[model samples]
Target: MLCLTGPTRAVTIDPPVLLAPMEGITDRIFRSLIAPHGGLGAAVSEFIRITVAPTPQRVCRRDLGPPIGVPVALQLMTPDDSHLAASVANAERAGAAWVDLNFGCPAPVVFSKCAGSALLAHPERIARIVATAAAATGLPVTAKMRAGISSPAHLRELVAAAAEAGAAAITLHARLRITSYDEPATWAWLAEARDALARCARPVPLIGNGGIETAADIVRMRAETGVDAVMVGRAALADPFIFRTAAGGPAPTVAEASAWALGYLDAIGSGSPKAKQLVRYWRCAGMLADPAQRQALLRGPTPAIAGFFTSLVPAGPAPPATRTSG
Candidate 1:
């Protein structure tokens, strides 16, 4: 747990931590595999790109059967205002618990459309989009964003625009649109976001994302950045159980991870699509293993990877990698 200093820190969201939506990762199967793991309180679906036409409910489902135990923010990505509003309504009609706008994706396709981080320079436009989505859905609406398009600064003005526009919460990914994963997370930006929100009349919870991988990062983030919580993406893909450990839930063993991994692959099915998704996913699961062991598994096939996990996990309560506890 993080110690308090200066003024008291409060988080309105429960579990306080959340799993981030990643392309190909954090999909429906991945979410179902990890959602019941005890620590995660919220979920965000992979970006549902909005077009001039309404997104089909079949596509909106994205294989999410139902809200198992928690609320899910169906993230809609688009540059069109009317389409965005329509998309949010369509998502809610299809059983969305919350609506999230994607102003954070830095993908080439997202850039070609001038959505996502491209709107960072246009705070007024971002505000207009948030307001439109919120009014359209009449449900809890949130947004995820990078600091800026070209500059690493501007979190102050950006966050206030989001808050005043009626976002129930906002997540700052702490990087510029052009910044890559090799860059360290600008945690100071989160501090800036907190201060900016504090000055707003409608200050909402600030959830920090980017570069939060280890259990230590989670604690330090809450204590140092003044964020209500942290969001995990690639690291969670490497170790799904990291969420449980970082948020004070019982940790899963190697044997457990092995079983879950096998089950997830099975659930995705054995078609060509399964093989394609599995290979890409296996590369990520290497992050679950220790450094000394990661490369071998990264190079090996699924059976070898599964065998490695089975051999390592003892037939007893597993010692967790994280120190976080309830």
Candidate 2:
């Protein structure tokens, strides 16, 4: 486990890896299933909108559900100063290990409200919001941002601003606002941001995100960017064991992968994270069945999905154990 020793909160993060929060995914159940299997250092919740009115708080209670195995960060995305501060304090009350400000979400719906990447147009305001959250609660305050709003060149200034405002760490997703996943993430941009922090003599950590799809990509992210940590995105959903495998944890067998994926779906209950994501997961893991079989698995009942996954594994020895457990 890697310990992030911020001024107020010192969080122990195992394997120095993080899960990038996905809007519909990355809910309570998703965090529970992944952290225990290995190599999950920490995870942030899906971005919670901090509006003019306070929303109901969601906490991880021991009796109601499985405990997430890593430091849990509650993420807040908003353009309102008071709302941001208030939400951070509420997250502290909800037992969040840290509070994360989301300035990196590129969704047009989010940006339309002057939040997310839209704030990149005003770097000083970004600094102000981070400073507000840090002051509002004793909880560790971190920020996730993109390279820039329109151009990657603007990241240097924003990185410096976040550091000066006492963000415990910064996560940089290497894409401009206008770009989509169709454009490749520029790892050089992350290096540039890290170097900027270094030049300032600030030991603030940088977490790199985007464009990772394999175990080797995880290694490359840390090696090339000089980042303190990395967040796995769609790739993690595709292969739940990628974190464990990349961290030198045991390689999961076919049965184990299916088990982990099934466990994740079951924990999800019903809603938000549709079971269709599992179809993509199967494809990503190169486990495509025949056309009729794939259609049946994807479109049939939930029980069928489970049966299909289970069928992938014949009678074999159990896979390597995950380092931790729910």
Q: List CA RMSD, all candidates.
A: 8.2, 5.5
The best candidate by lDDT is 2
Q: Quote the lDDT for 284 in model 1.
A: 35
Q: For each candidate, what TM-score against the reference?
A: 0.83, 0.88
Quote the positional error of residue 60 for candidate 2 in Å: 8.6
- lDDT by residue (78-170, candidate 2, tens digit) is 875866666676777777888889998888888999999899988889999989888988777889999998798778999889888888889
Question: Model 2: how far is 59 from its true place, Å?
Answer: 6.8
TM-score of 2: 0.88
The residue-by-residue lDDT of candidate 1 on 1-326, one tens digit each, is 21111111222345777778787777877788887876776778888888778777677776455665766668887775867777777787787667778998898887888888888878898999988887886577888999888785677889899889988888899989989977888988888888899899987878888897665677788899999878887767666777777777655655676666667656775332443344343433233435445555556665565455456555667777787788
> Model 1: runs farther than 4 Å from truth?
1-13, 270-293, 299-326
Pairs with backbone N, CA or C atoms under 3 Å apart (clashes), candidate 1:
none
